[model samples]
Target: MTPFRTLTAEQIASLEALGNTAEDWSQVRVSEDFQPFQLQQSRLEGEVRIGSEARIIHSRVRNCQIGEGSLIEDVTALECRHRSSFGNGVGVATMNECGGRTVRIFDTMSAQMAYVMALYRHRPQTLAALERMIDRRVEERQSEIGRVGRNCRIVGARFLREVCIGDEVRIDGASLLENATLCDGVEIGVDVKACDLIAAEGARIGNGSTVERCFVGESCILDKGFTAAESLFFANSHCENGEAASIFAGPYTVSHHKSSLLIAGMFSFFNAGSGSNQSNHLFKSGAVHQSVHLRGCKFASGAYIMSPALEGAFTMVMGHHSYHHDTSALPYSYLIEKEGRSHLMPGANLASYGAVRDIEKWPARDHRKLKRDVIDFDEYNPYVTQAMLDAVNILHTLQEQDPDAEVYTYNKTLIRAASLQRGLKLYNKAIVAALGSMLDRGESNPRHNGAGRWIDAAGQYITRQAMREILDAVDRGELTDPTAVDNRFRIFDVHYDDYAHSWALQVYASLLGHTPTVGELNDAIQAGRNAHAALREMTDADRRRDCSLDMAVGYGLDCDNEEDRRRDYFAVRGLK
Candidate 1:
């Protein structure tokens, strides 16, 4: 369908002086170098195709199809249709009266800002059945010239009636956008405001970010006054300032300070310090509640949490706690707060050295480049040292079931009876330093038949009756189905697979009861590897006596001696 070029009684008096009113001007069509005074008073319908250095200024369209060097500035297109390899080298700038009515096609160039956020949040009966499918592509572009490709751009967008954009994307100075799908090279900064979103590709919506019903993946980064609702962020997540409701931010999730607030939680590589917050609901009934921290966790600066807690994996929390503490069996512990209470310090971080420098800086702060659809999170395993050896065998069976009870009253806080006998001698010297580093790495690596294979306390492997059938499948609930607890912690995270290290080698062979001999499993793996290398050399001599510079001495009361106050604090703090 290519043969229509009529519109020239001086372009019908320059389109009735720039306010086009066409009931029929031979179904207005232009190309063959169309130029009725560069056209004006726009109002065209069906069988309309304008190309050859295309330009349709002062707009009001219906039943559309215009390609070839495309540009429809000051726009308003209704009942749209155009699907040829789709609306080429596109560009639309609307705002000249009836600033709303859908049907836009900016074919392939990396999803135009995800179509201005899904064509400005559609619904006018789905914007009149997508403008009757762009008036059946203006009667098949009346004769041809539809294929505009070469660096497209849509600017000063407003009340985008119903969006669906893609290709070499870049929507500048956007103020209002409805619905959404800005995939490919998406970059919508400057006064950005999106609704019902779905931004993928190199996602970046900085300058005053505001998205609703969100779902941003790929290279994510929602900057500044970031506000999100019904959220879901994956990929390299980075949410600035703060405010996320119904949150689920997986992939390297990072929340830049500024009174941070992440609601209805579920995060990943998560780091929310400055005024970190959370607390879904506590109305006793209504707003329900929620909270779960699994991945390489950390929350310091004015940290606060409240929502039926479950924290674990590489755990480390600071102050504020509104009761509800369920350290999901205490993985890599440290949940502080002195006077006000809550202090369960098992293996006091197995002689600290800052929890072995946060387990040697989480595999060098893995900033995952790609390859991540989901399931694959191992922030140091043995399922958090077997929930810190079942909170040190439930604090040694609640200190042998209350040896004259009152060692800081249980589950309400305050645990000093010299921290419950130095947390039961630092949880039996961290379960004999995790059974002597699992019998010195299973008698220096001797798998089976030699009847000499053991491992567990964290060295890893499986036996002792496949860890007592995973604590009898978590006591018959078979890991309470969430896809059988994510496939029983993905078969206890497969590496050296023995039925994925036999669910913590059957909970350390049911905390060592039946079958234990190869010299009582090499003397409980050399007493948990010499009490985890003597609690990491007594937490590196208590962090070198809590970072001693002669412990400061009240910041050296205006220097004098002590080498002129250590050379006036290394000349105003130079050398450490």
Candidate 2:
């Protein structure tokens, strides 16, 4: 620890001349290398300490101690007290309000933004304890500056009254920060202003951003004219060039468009396109409009959705729709609009090579390097596919009950007669494909011991005893919580071999009233695999046909041939 020192009476007087007024001279303290001439008019109350070879200019301080080898230049410290200790080579810039009142600057340490929110907003008792801890460090010279970790820099900040700044932080050209805690390695860019905000570690706020009453999570980025009010953004998310109000953005959420506005809703891993917007109220009596977009969802450009709609996982939506459609039962499907009418196409994406490609790409798309505070999501979930299979059964039942019923007439949407017939065939094919894929992959696993176990009375290849064990584990409040869920997924991600097949066997057993023999189970698995592979090939072929060269003929107006049309398109673009 460095030794203690005090400023001379002449230095105290000089500080007073520079717009600083101290209630008592004996209360002021400085390092041995402190110069009286550099001191400005500043009020020193209780006990104040300045660092060795440090500069104190134009600031009012009360009940705080400055650390040795630190600089307090042109900064006001009011009622601003630090009971904590600061490491060597720290710097602080402060300014006083118009009424000549002082502000408190506390020690720095990084915590999750959500944790800070819970601390300050939800648990006031906890914050009071932390504040008291800071207040108690006034007397001891060894406890002066808050000891932050190495290579931290804070510059050009007008810290308002009552703020908590964390260690290893960097703030540059920040204006009007009040009632906030900035966690470790947080970088606040130029002209960035925030109030009542908490920024987690490794988070970045770009230049000219404004945030109010928000919690920004770890490794999240908000830059280039982003503005958020009363929002909570979780880990590994990115929001840029947009405005958000009263929104909760979950993990891996991304919105990067100037005209996009996310308001009063919940979203995760959501991609909002340019001009994409949602209506929270339809000139209603109150503010009771909200929409939910589950994980792995995409919104096309210029898409507009009204409230009270629930879209399922891995669903792609295109065109504008005002109707409240509930497609939660259908996963990995496409909902398109034709002539102002919503059209439901079941299993439209099932055979598409793009769907498979997307599944393969999501795991590799992880950009977060730091460990997250919240649970990481599984982009591909067997549970979701199982739900889809259940939906297929329900839709099949509906068709058999009314062969003449319009397939698309659900929640004010229309399904053509042809579409209905095709949808059922496609859904069945998808179910078979999924089951086959599971069995084939499982058989290749090293854990496979010559066809594994025999079927139980419940018609499951895995015994009812095993099924009950798995369900009981989930029901015993073991997998419901976030931590448990995350741990389970982490293990599943690494060693999910044969798990999908096991789940399939369970589903098949549930569907069949009687248990099948081992040979029958193996035969079913092989048939399912072949059907799935054939469907995938068909889906890929359809995609190719959709992308034919002749499809661009109408797209390029007034062009004679395909070659001329292509040249015209490129030539028009080259002019720019």
Candidate 3:
């Protein structure tokens, strides 16, 4: 341990002059950089320990351990009632707020892990073991002194209790923050009230937001007085002026504008327009309803859906929907309410130009600059492809089982026979698009061979087979800690391409219904790549059409002639 500088009697007198008092004078640990002139009207109580270059003005702290270069100004109170791991192992009741639906919030909680915890309740022993592991972590984090990390600023805060603050954090104008763990580079801004939260690195919570039992992932923003409860928002999610409950929001889930309530839904790569909402209650006794909004879904303004509905990937919903629909086999389509009935438009979103840009721009939009591990951004992976494969199977089964039915209705969702056929084509197109990318990579590098079932545990994509190997080792006492499950996530976090190719290979096998020889795989790969290249060309043409001279006819008001118009178009569009 580094030695602490002993202050002179004159320094003690100077500290007394500043109206600063400590419960135990011997417990006060200052450094050579410490200056008495910097502290003013601050009270340190109950085993409080402070670090060098600290500026404490108009604040009172009890059992707090403040780090070097920290600034605590105009803070009402900072205290710890008891030993806490902040958010770890704290049970949150989601969906039915009743018993048996409690999920443990840990620092390592990811959307994929939470998915397993929430949906895999059928595996009691496995869940119990995971919960026990988290509880052990909670116990291990117990400390008498609440910690404030280095270079952090705690200004104008109402109250902070048992919170583990991280390096370079800023918590200003927060009403009440208790039992929360803030990782490095987190910013909690004005009028924020939170409890039992674990905000990952570069996460921001501000603008009068009220949050409880929430895990805000890296670079996520919850601002503009948004209210959230029992939600697990993953990387780069942004929610403002909306209410969310029991939402397992995955990467890039954005809901802005007022009166938007996302409740009891599992979503990823989602975008919600103004007044977008979901009804989880059936006007019944218990709110046990939940839904899954698969990858790249969007909801138009004033859109609503009654839950227990499972929507497919990249699907769009519009208008108020009282009738629940399970459109799990229909990707790149619209589920619209027409005259109080639902209508499905197949292969519509595939033509959307925005869809191409949305996927391309996600990597650039990441706000987490300090840490890369805390942020997850992937275009093609097992999670989405797995869903697509499942959708393909569903469509195939539906068509084969009811060959004669003109209209098919199952699980409250309706699909026309003709539309079903179109949906299959669209889904296959999507799969082929992914397969093309994977094959191009594989062809470019023949030495690498990645094959298997990928599991999305947190943001990491690991082969289920690899995970089982680790778990088997754990069961044999080769791996002692249950947190070894985290290793599976870490593997994919670093080696994403391996997992990607693995999933691609597995999906290819499933599509053909048998394993192909290397030569056969190559032939299929080339054909898919050729088709995908044509598709990409078409998409590029569509993109150009938006900014082309034809689309900019009204923009060049000052143009004299066709030449001037061409010049103006080039100037504004900035492309050939």
Candidate 4:
């Protein structure tokens, strides 16, 4: 590639003849093979550089660099106001709207990093070190000239000020994009108004969405008039026709309803039904409460919950729950409201077809081209299984406390006797199955990590000890940088199987009261396979309900006979 050269007298004369004007012609520089005729009716100001084969038609571009093969046509104002960081150092108040958990969002920040920043407020020194590192990187990015990378097309844009456009980006009819960073492969569609935002690679913002002070992660889609502020939406999360404020939406968090409001919460691998909303304020004080919904959770239509609640993974919530119960110990449960009282059915969603299908579909639905988030898609990993183990202990203790009681009360939610017994069996089977699965992986030699507790750091499952070592290193000035800490997280993901196997060994010893011999291990593996089969059968029965006559009522509307109705239903649904 040849170096940029000042516009020659002949090229300057030709550009003026083509209705192009510059504040100072000498300040305009172009590539060695730049074409003068490709630019028309544009005003350039304050040291503008255009690359080879790049065209600017009917636009006013000031203090900008246009990369090779880029096009800027009919844009209202493409200018850099002053020295700016392009949304690199913006602080998004995620998870808590009251300002305790603010994450400084940057261009290269991943979901795991944001998770640690938002949730690990207990570790102040580590957080401070991470913030200092981000601040240094942000300072390094300060510039007076906006940049449009190679192959970018900005057509019919209204107001783009102090923005950085990366390679292969597309911006058409964007209303206002101020102080924003559109990373590589981003698509900004009609009427999108994004301010103080960092959109990572492969993200799309369109359909009249309004985003302010947010970090839109890789391959995310925000459309259909969605409004978001002070939020962090991580990889592959989709939001349409809804509003999100002060939310930490991790990977695969999806809310597609027009009436849904996701605010002041942490959610991952979540689904929000229509009219699903949560209250962060009780009218006693300002909106200070925050909620945590773990991965693979779903809020049923019109469901409501008061904040300061923590829900378990893979739990399905229905109706209105104002009790603010924390069910973090019970995974794969149902939290339903009955007659104005909260009812908890433990381990019920293990048999749910939707829950099982969600785990299967999430990996297939991932659309990220440049994947940044380190995600593990296993359904029965150590994170949820640890919760299952805790729930098993709690259920057994409750049974021993009152063996004849019909209803058990825990955490302000009532659990029936039948639910308790069923949950015990289901959790035990799942635990055994997970142990056997880990055993089958042949990780006979356990890693030093994954001994005690496990945490789902956004989409990555890591042991508490491994996470502690990283944070401790940061606090002691040994890590000192975000990249080093992120690498540690990535390494944990790479060795996830080993960590899980170690945790499974602990679980096996705890369950059977001794280290498993070779024969016992073989028996456990066979039993685990049988348990997996039984769980699958339960889910299969739940799936068949979708083809039931009641569910087929809306289908086969044009058919009168039962046979024709069944045929039309099966045909339309692609079921036999």
Candidate 5:
């Protein structure tokens, strides 16, 4: 820390002449190279320390330490009344609004940490240990004086109290920001009203949004009048013109529609279409129920569901559903309401062009400067393959039980006979293709052991045993803080490919009932290639529907002839 010197007699006179007033001249301190002329029409009170080249113009700064090259211009009031942690230790009641699921928000909180905190209540001792680690992190942030870091520009802001601004941040035209930690490189834009919030590095909270008790992750964007309270939003999430309450939104969760309300749910890699909604209260009890939509799930326009439900990965939900079905064992499927009944088309999304597009685009769309959360972008990882494996067996059993039935019921969702047959084949094909891809990686030996149940931790795929070991380390008092836990997660990320290979080998051995010979392995590889080609062909055909003649109806509205319409349509929607 650079030493601060009391303002000189001449410097005080110069500041007074420029309409700057200090409560006590002795209490005001400045850096060795501080320029008195830089401050204009500002009131400094209660131990203000100004760094070199920092300018406080037309602002009221109280009990604050302004860093080098920082400009606090055209502000109303900036004050720290008491010792503040700047939104650290603020508990966000995520997943359950009425209580029972709350995550402590801190400056360095990652998605994986929050995931364990909110969802691992079954392990009470582990949750207690994790909470202690977070408490220690929050204690480190407590300070009597608020700080504005180097090169930050807070312009046209009104009423900022107990806010800790980090390096290179830009706060413009914000209104009533209180008790918030704006991390390094954060941008707070026009008319944002935030309280008890932690905006992580490279995050932007702008466009008249209202956020309270929220932990905005790195590179996440919340804008366009988005209102959120008691929510935990993770890396790369984008929300605009929507409302989110009590939601544990994992990485890449997006809700852009004006009429969407995502509440009391755990979601990751999800997209909420226009008017998407979910109800957690059935009126029998206070709002206590919660829902889970796994990775790559999408809710179509006007989609609604009651809580106490679980959706599978890459499942597309449409219409209203209140039956509270669990489709977790059926990945890449469609759950749509047809004729007032829930219809489940298991593994139907495998042939969807949109599903393939989503998997391809997530990695490219990540905007985080430092990706602390580990993300496995493989669409057919061990977690998803396990779901597919279960789906195949379930389909086979259903077919055997009712050979002539037109519709089969499972988990209160109806599946047509033809849809079941097609889904079984699709699931089998996907399993073979995924196994072949894993075999081609050439991993003879793996470092991390992957056995037992697999889970998708936000975006990363890992064995449940590995997650439990991390918790055990925490409970044993070895991993003392959040940083130590993050380092372990990083190590897991580094060895992800090797772990996946080991798990795939186990799956292969289980299928063959013994170690595969060289000839058998070669045959399996060829069969996987064929299945992959077939699945790809189906998705390609689905893509062709985008350029069909019916879809081009609005493209050439003013065209007089069919030839002119064709030319215009081809110009806008080119054949790709």
Candidate 6:
């Protein structure tokens, strides 16, 4: 594959001038401008190939293919013993680790996929089919040699084995890396030790971090001595100074504290505070307990959760709790500990401007350098809103089942009658807010698109009917692989709102026991507009208060009196 050629006497003379030696000159293939003097004390062994401009590769280069203009310096060894697909078809032993459920990882694997794999074990044949596809992909790339791409730099990296380095990657002071695939623009910094990793473009791991059998998605960073094992992190994830095991981090999930232990959980768009922790083992025999802390959940400092718990999206945990609660129906609530029991405060985050600010900041914080691998976008998009609608519908069913139940307890989480009523109101408002968001963004009619059951195709929000048609084609062998599925998933992030509106209106109409006509859609649009106007007014008022003189009291310098300080603050504030 390298366009190998035997070394002639003149070519040998040219190589010798560079002061490098190959165990078998015939196995070493170089371009026309090959210079042996450029390589010093480097042993090229077992079919090593160097491009035209690469120089000073390593102490030992075994079965490696170096691309043009790459620089490798101060590395102890680079070896590839066997052909590996990096993280393709990587089956991570989660939960018990005695091998109950193995989450298979692929390059295009999304956090949604990992979540389904961990929780939806009832669909065995489907998971097996997905795993088989990944296996086929791994077998397709049957090559033993490692690779260093063009314009890449490896400095002070002590050991690398069976790794496929993409173009323009930077590995500096990394101790060891094995069976990894690094995409373009990736950087592995000081004392990083990784095994079985797939780092997409703009992914960075540094500051004494250690990763084992992890899928570090595009633009994800694990720094400041973070330790992770068997974790799957998607685009724009960040973790530092903590430990994560058997975790699934979706886009924009961040935990930046030393004592954070995010283990055996599924998370996305989430944040963990300092000393936040969770146990996969509920004092069980074999650490078999698992949990689902869904997207946009946050934790206060020193907070602890005992799993097998399921806390819903945007829920905030504020204290230590050993109760295995399922607050999946109570999104954007606070789960606190009162008298060693779980106390639920519903819709509390709705009052916090911080939650709104977090949603605003996620889309703006995308750091992915590779556009191809970035799957999730618009962190608080309509996809999440659809999920909330689904949750609200489930709550409705529960209420219908027990008309007079006082304190409804489902899955260890207690919900008072007042809280349930308030939650339904809040959930309705949230949906209205979502619909209003769609309407304000020029969607005058909600029934314009996505007019069917929306199916979650591993993170791709698509119409279920269309997915059924695609899967039917796959069954017929008309589509050999899942190309159609991937193409449908490859749609841009902009369409999420349109699709969500169509689906939300349908769901809203269903709750009312009727199909939504154009008039209903228009009415929903009007409601949405009203909600938007109110939100704008509230946010503007809040911003005004934030810039007021009360907030600027300590910063006004050279002010002789309170009035002068207030005037100076107003001058800087430029408040109307």
**Stretches of model 1 off by over 4 angstroms after superposition:** 1-189, 192-223, 226-238, 242-316, 319-332, 335-344, 347-372, 376-503, 506-576
- How large is the C-alpha RMSD of every model relative to the true structure? 21.9, 10.5, 3.9, 1.2, 1.2, 4.2
The 10-residue segment of model 4 with minimum total lDDT is: 441-450
Q: Which candidate, 1 or 3, has the higher TM-score?
A: 3
**Clashes found in each candidate (C-alpha, N, C closer than 3 A):** 58, 30, 1, 0, 0, 5
Ranking by lDDT: 4, 5, 3, 6, 2, 1
TM of each candidate vs. truth? 0.32, 0.65, 0.86, 0.98, 0.98, 0.85
User: Tens-digit lDDT track for model 5 on 1-576?
Assistant: 867998889999999999999888898889999888889999998989998899999999999999999999999988888999999999999999986899989998888888889889999998888888878878889988999999999999999999999999999999988999999999999999999999999999999999999999999999999999999998999999999999999999999999899999999999999999999999998899999999999999999999989999999999999999899999999999999888999999999999999999999999888887778898757899889999999999999998999999999799999999999988999999888776655465655777678898877787898898898999899998898988888788787777777777788989999988778777777777888898899999998886777787777789889988888888888753
Clashes of 5: 0
Weakest lDDT window of 10 consecutive positions for candidate 3: 441-450
Residue 209 in candidate 1, Cα distance off native in Å: 5.5
CA lDDT, every model vs. true structure: 0.55, 0.57, 0.75, 0.91, 0.91, 0.73
TM-score of 4: 0.98
> What is candidate 4's lDDT per residue for 1-576, written digit by digit as tens?
437899889999999999999999898889998878979999999979899899999999999999999999999999997999999999998988878999998898989889889989998888899999999989988899999999999999999999999999999999999998999999999999999999999999998999999999999999999999999999999999999999999999899999899999999999999999999999998899999999999999999999989899999999999988999999999999999988999999998889989999999999987677889998768899989989999999999999999999999899999999999999988987888887666374544556888999999999888888888988888886677888889988888888888888778877789998889888888888888889999999999886676788777788878899889888988888
Whole-structure CA lDDT of model 1: 0.55
- Give candidate 4's whole-model lDDT: 0.91
Tell me how candidate 6 scores on lDDT.
Answer: 0.73
* TM-score of candidate 3 versus the correct structure, residues matched by position: 0.86
lDDT of 6 by residue, 1-576 (tens): 345456678767766666667778888878766766657767778988888778874477888888888888878888788777765666776543445667766655555446546655775655566566667777765488888999999988898988889899999999999878888889999999998788877899998999998888888899999999988788888999999988767777789999899887777778999999988664557677777776678989988988778886679998877778887766778887767777776665655566677778876887765444324433324555666676677667768889898867666666667877777766667667766555444342444366665543334455655545544544454544444445544552346556655656555676669976777777877886676556546555666677766698675698788878887777777864
Ten contiguous residues with the weakest lDDT in model 1: 93-102
Model 2 spans with C-alpha error above 4 angstroms = 1-150, 351-361, 373-380, 405-407, 429-502, 512-576
